[model samples]
Target: MSDHGGSGEPTPRILVFSTNNISDPGIDLAGSRHLHYPATVSVLAMPCSSGIKPSWILHALQAGQDGVFIASDGEECAYLPDCAERTAHLVTVTQGLMAEQGLEPQRLKMAAVCSVCAEPFAKYMREFAAALSTLGPRPVTAG
Candidate 1:
């Protein structure tokens, strides 16, 4: 992570898993509207949220991401009718795994983002960034 304007505080690095058919458009709309959100966030678009593996989330943290956010399709999913429920279960399972690895459960978050949810997407990012700032950088473990 890089310093925040040389304030000596490390900027949080967030990884977002966005659904291609739903959340991606919302995120794009947020960007197109010039909505303010932290630049530290990096999005990876996938086919669906429910397909995300628990190990992938842990690997993101282990690989130096300060936090992870899942932008789910909710009821607007094109792939599965129960995408929201499945994604919620995935979050729960991943959280448990995170706790077992000594990671804070709050470091992970999830929210439904529809195609027109630009404001909500931006809001989520800002809020997540603030929460991550409060948590500080992910602890550097000695290998």
Candidate 2:
């Protein structure tokens, strides 16, 4: 197992998958606010919600991340209804699969936020991080 900060204390890792052009300004600010955990969060930007694949999420966990957060501009999806629907469905399915594999269900999460929803999106991220801290770090495994 990897130590949280080289201090030997375990820390949780968070990965944020954001839709392309949908920037998350709150990430750095939130990390600064939550200095206790030392905020081991990484952000990955995708071209769109549809760009995210199930394998990506699985790979993140397998790579030792404790949690994953996906955010997209649902109402502004380029594919409109179809793209939004597909992303939602994929998230639901992914959550189920993660739980089945003994990973924490909360490890996989999805949020629909546009440029205007920055506050709420940040709130969600903070809440998610807090929840994950309570759950503790997940054990890394080799499949």
RMSD of every candidate to native, in Å, equals: 1.7, 3.8
TM-score of 1: 0.93
TM, every model: 0.93, 0.76
Global lDDT for candidate 2?
0.71
Best by TM-score: 1
- What is the lDDT for 83 in model 2? 68
| Candidate 2, residue 87: lDDT | 82
Give the whole-model CA lDDT for all candidates, comma-separated: 0.90, 0.71
Q: What would the per-residue lDDT of candidate 2 be over residues 18-100, giving only the tens digit for each residue?
A: 76555453344444454333357678877777778888898888887888888876767665557677888888888787777
Q: Which candidate is the best by lDDT?
A: 1
